[model samples]
Target: MPSQTKRKKPYSHFRLRKFLFFTVPFTILALFLLRTSSSSSSTASVSSSYTTYQPPWFGDLQTAQFPWNRLAFSLTNPPPKTLKLAVFSRKWPTGPNPGGMERHAFTLYTALARRGHRVHVFTSSLDPFLKTDKIINLKIHPHGDAESGKWRYNKAWELYQEENQKQPFDVIHSESVALPYWKAREVPNLAVTWHGIALESLHSSIYQDLIRKPGEPRLQSFNASLYSAVLPKILDEIRFFNNYAHHIAISDSCGEMLRDVYQIPEKRVHVIFNGVDENGFTSDKKLRSLFRSKLGIQENSSAIVLGAAGRLVKDKGHPLLFEAFEKLIETHSNVHLVVAGSGPWEQRYKKLGDQVTVLGSLNPNELKGFYNGIDIFVNPTLRPQGLDLTLMEAMLSGKPVMASRYPSIKRSVVVNDEFGFMFAPNVEALTTVMEVAVAEGAERLAERGRKCKEYAAEMFTASKMALAYEKLFLCIKDERFCIYP
Candidate 1:
C-alpha cells in the first residue's frame, strides 16, 4: 500500500507540472493579444473620431453669410414673443470706457432689450459715474463691494438663483467664466461665450516667445515645470469645459478648437462673431477732416496717419510696433502713428515725439473721432486669442487695417486681402507692410476703406449680432425655433 501511494503521488505531481507548463504559456499569450487588440481599438477609435466627426455648420464662415435681410424681417415683423434672459457678467460697462468683453456684453444686452426682450444682468458693482436710468427693459443686479471694484461671482450667482426662482429665466448667458461649470451644469438653457480659451492662451504664449529676440528670456521656461504645471492646467481646463451645457465661440478658430480639441459635441457648440455699433462708427467725410485737422495733419497733406488702439502692453505687441514704427519713421517722413489707450508703454510711445500721437485714454466719442481721423488702422497684437473688436471697428469706421497674420485675423477678419494688409508678428514684416501703406498713398487706402466699410456693415454690425443671439436664445427656449434659412 505504501509503495502504491508513493507512485501515485509522483504521477499526480507530474500531471500538475504538465498542466502548468501549457496553461501558463497560453494565459500569457492571451493577455498579450488582448492588450494589443485594446490598444489598437483605442487608437482606431480616436482616429475615427477625428476623421468622421463633422459639425453640420462646418464651412468657410466668411462665405457663409447670414441672411441679414431675412433676419431683419424676422426681428422687425415677429410674433409677440420675447425672451426673459439672465446674464452673468463679471463687470458690466458702466462708464464710457470698458474692456472689450464688457463692451460686447453691453452691446448685445442693450440690443436685445431694445428688441423688447427683458434682460436681467447680474454683475459687479457699477461705477459711480454711470447712469442706468435711460436703459429700458434691462434691470441691473449689482453685487460685491463698490469701493474695491472686486467682482464676487458667488454673490452674483446667488442673485441669479433668487431671480430664477421668482421667474425662471428662458435662457441664461454667461460672458466667459462669470458662471462656473459646477453651476452651469445644472442649467439646461445656458450658453457660455468663450471670448478666449486656455489653449488659445497657450498659443499666445508661444507667439510671444517667437516675437521675442533670440537671446531674450522666454515667457515660459522649457523645463519640467512645463510638463508638471502648464500642460496639466490646460488638460484640466479641457476636462472642465465638458461640464458646460453649451459653448459659444466668438471666433471661427475658437469654435473649431472647442469642438475638435475640447471634444464638445457638435450640436452644443456654436460660433458667433463679435459686433460693434455701426452708427457710432461710420464713414463721415466731415468727421475725418475735422479729426485730421485736430491732429495737425492738413486735409490736403500727403502724410498718412496710421492708428492703433488698445491697452499699451507688451502682449498688445507695442514693443514690435514701437520698433517697427521707429524703423518706418526713419525713412518715410509722410507716415505718422496714433496710439490710443494707456499702459506701461504710454511713455515709450510719447518719446517717439511728433511722429507718434499718444491720445492717452479716449472716451467712446473720442474713439469714434480717432477711427475717422486715421488713414489706416494698424493692429500689431502678438496674442492670438480673441478677435480684437478694434479690427471690426476700424473696418466699420471706413478705414483699412494692417494687422498681424494670426489665424483668428486671417480666418475671420482678413479673409480678403483687399480689406487690408497682414504680416507676421515681427518688426521686419510690419515695417514692410507700413512701407507699402505709405507707397499706396492715402487715396488708394481710402478706396480700400470704402470696400472695408461695405463689408463691415454686412458682417460686424450690432443688429446682425443681436439677431443671431436672439435666434439662438429662442432656439434654446424651444427646439422648434431652431429652423435654419
Candidate 2:
C-alpha cells in the first residue's frame, strides 16, 4: 500500500506543475488583453480628424492605402496646366511624428497638389496603421523595408526610371541634396533644396566651443579624427548640392553658405522662405481661455505665458533657456513657461517647478490651441540651420517671438521692438529679453502680437509659398522663372 501511494504522489506533483504553468500564462494574456481594450476604447473619444489628417490626394480608397482618412482644406483652385511632379522625400507625412524635412515636403506638396499638379511622393517611411502601398491621383511609394539605404536608393532610382518610361516627370525636386536619380545628373530638369550643410552647421558655438560641457555638439566628439573621416563625405555632399541646375535655399543664410562655402554658382542658388498654414493656425479668444482654464489659470489672470517647442536638445539651447527662465521666475511671479515636445534632455530640466507646464507632443489642432494660449513664443536654438517653422506658426497665431539671433532668422524675420524680439542664445541675453517683455507691459505686448499676425499673414501663408513655387517651376520649364531685374 505504501509503494502504490508513492507512485500516485509523483503523478500528482507532475500534474500540479503543468496546471500552474498554463494558468500563469493564461492570466498574463487576459490582463494584457484587458489593458489593450481599455486603452483603445479611451482613445476612441477624440474626433477622427484629430487622429488622422488625410491629404486631398488620398481621395480614392481603391488605388490608395491611406493610413487614415484625414483632411485639411485651403482656398485655392487647381492650376490650368497638368504638370507631372515627382517629389523625393524619404518620409511620407502620414502621422504627427514628422521631422522638419517631412513637414517641408508635406506642406509644399499639399499646396502644389491643390494647384492641379499630378504629384507622386516617393518615400522610405511606412504607415504604422496600413502596411501597404498607397496611390490615388497622387501616389505615395513606400520603400522603407529595403535591406539598406544603398539598396533603397538603387531601387528607387530604377523604379523612377520605369515610372518615367510610362509617364515622364516634368520636374525632379528632392529634399536637401538627396537626389537618387536613375540617370544621376542626366535627370533632365533637376533641383534640390538645402536643409543644412554639414560643414557650415559646425560654425555654431555649440559645435565650435572648446571646453566640453554636459550638453555639447556630437560633431566635436571625434574632434580631428571625426572631421578627417567625414571630410570627404561632406565634400561629396557639396558635389551633390552643386549637381542640380537650380538650388533652392530655404533661407538667405543657407544661400550665402551655398555660394561661399560650397562655391555654388550664384546663377543656381535661389532663396525662398518657409510658409505656414494660416487657416490651420489661428488665435481665438475662446480657445485661449479654454486652454488657460485647463492649465488652472483664472479667466481674469494676465500671467505672461512663454512657450517653446522643439525636440529638447543642447543645440536647441534649452539648458540656457531653462536657466534664464529660472532666473526670470524668481523675480516675477506672474511669468510662466510652457514647453511643447519632448526628448532626452526632458528629465534633466524638470526642476523648473509649478510655473512650468510640459505638454509633451501635440497634434496640429492641439498645437494651434497651445500657440493661441501663450503670450510670447520663444525659440532659443543656438544652431538654427534652417528657418524654424515654429516662428511662422506662432506669428500666425498672433504671438510675438523672442528667438535666437541666428543669421537666417535675422534675414528672414522682421524682428523689431514692435514686431518681435531677438536675443543672443545664452542665459544672460534671454533673461534680458524676458525683463524687457515684462517692462513693456500687457498692452504693448498685445499690439506687438497683432503686428506679428499681420506680418505672417502677408509673407508666410502656404498659398503664397505655393504660388511662388508654381511660378518658379514655370520659370525653370521655360527659363522665364526669375523675377529679379
Candidate 3:
C-alpha cells in the first residue's frame, strides 16, 4: 500500500505540472487579446468623430475679405517701409530636398533679401547657409536637430520671443504642417503655410504605408509599419487648426481644405502657388540623347519613354505606377519607364522586370538632363498632396505631364488638359492614360509640352510666388500697405 501511494503521488504531481504550463500561457494570451481589443475600440471612437463636420460653421470661407489679385504684381516691390521679417522653417534650401516647402522658403527669403528687407530665417540646420552672420542681410539660424521637431519648435518659440523684444517683427510665418498651436498671445501677427492638412492625411494613412501627415502620432502599436486609426495627433489637430486666424495655403485646394475642413475664414487663408528653379530644369538636346542611351533605349526604335521623380512612398503610388506599367506594356511594346528618386519602395520596384531605369535621386545638374530624356512625366500620387515640385520641374523642361486628379494639383498646376493629363487614383485610370500617352502622335505631344512650358514660366515662377506672399504680408501688417499693386 505504501509503494502504490508513492507511485500515485508521482503521477499526480506530473499531471499538475502539465496543467500549470498550459494554464499560465493561456491566461497571459487571454489578457493580451483583451487589452488589444479594448484599445482598438477606444481608438475607433476618436477616428470616427473626425469623419464628418458641420458646413459654414466649420470655416467654409467661400468669400475672402482680402482678395489680392496675382496678375497685379510681377515683383515684390517695397511700399515705403522695408519691414523686418522673421521666418520659421523646420528645413532649409541647402538640404537634399531642393523642392517642396523648403524650396519655396528659400526662393521667398532670397527674393525678399534681394529687395533689401532685413530677413532672418530660424530653421533646423547644422550647416547653415549665408557667408556672414550679419543681421541686415539674409541669414539662417541653426537651432536644434529636426529629429526632435517638438524640441525645435519650443526652442524656435523661445528664440522668436527673445528676438522680438530686441526688435519688433512685422510678420512671423511658420510652416503650417506643424504650427505650434496658438502662442497667439506671444505673437502680434502669425501666418502658417499649409503643405498638407492633418485630417486628409489621417484618412489616407489607414491604408497607405508610412504616410502620416503632420508629425507621427503617439502610436498604440510597437511596429511603425502598423498604425492605429485612432490618431492622437489628428485628434489634437481637430482643435489645433482653429488656433490661428491667418493661414497661408500653398494652393487653392489647400486654401479650400483650410476653409472647409478646419473652417478658417477665406479672408484669413491666403492662396500662393509654389515655384520651380526655371534655369535649373531646362531641356538639353545633347543630354537627352545621352540619358536615353544610358537607359538602353535604341536610337531607331519608336520607344515612348515615361518618367517619374520624387520620394517613392505609398502615397506617391509606386505600386500603382509599376502595376499599371506592367498592364500598359502588354500591347505597347514600344514603351519604357524611367524613375528618378529612391525610397522604401525601391526593393519592390526592382522586381517589376521591364525596361525600367531607376535613376536614384538626381543632382541639380542631372535633373535637366533627366527631364530632357523622358517623353512624358507622370505623377501617380494617391493623396491630395498640395503639389509636387517634380511635376513643375517636368513642365518647365517642356515635357508633357500625366498626374493624379487631386484637387490641389488640378487647381494649382493642371490648369488645363492641354498641358497634361489627369487620371483618377487607380491602376485602371493610370493604365488608360499611359496607353493614350503612348498612342498620341509626337507632334501633338510636343505641342502640349510647349504649352505647359510657356504656362509654367508665366504662372509658377519663384518671383511671382514671392510677390504674392509679400503682398499678403503687407496687407496683414498695415491697412495702407494693403493697396493693390
What's the lDDT of the predicted structure labeled candidate 2?
A: 0.70
Per-residue CA lDDT of model 2 for 154-266, tens digit only, reads 55666677788898888878886456533447765777777877754665644335323558655545667446644765677677655567777776566666776678877
What clash pairs does model 2 have? 54-70, 64-135, 79-115, 475-481
Candidate 1 RMSD to the correct structure: 11.2
Worst 10 residues of 1 by lDDT: 43-52
Q: What is the lDDT of residue 62 in candidate 2?
A: 19
**Model 3: runs farther than 4 Å from truth?**
1-69, 76-80, 125-136, 144-151, 177-179, 206-235, 298-301
The candidate scoring highest on TM-score is 1
Q: After superposition, how far is residue 474 of candidate 2 from its true place, in Å?
A: 1.5
Clashing pairs in 1: none
* TM-score for each candidate, following the candidate numbering: 0.84, 0.78, 0.77
lDDT of 3 by residue, 279-335 (tens): 777767798889888888876667888999988877788878988998887787788
Model 1 lDDT per residue over 1-485, tens place: 45654346658989999999999999987985566455434322221222234234433222232222113325466534798999999888766568888999999999999999999999998776767666898999999655524678889888998998999999999999899888888888899999888777776776777776778876456545456766787798789888888788776667666766788887788777788998899877888888888888887899999999999999999999999999988888888899999999999988887999898899878888899999999999988887899999999998999999866676667756778899999899999999998999988999999888877776678887888788778878887667654
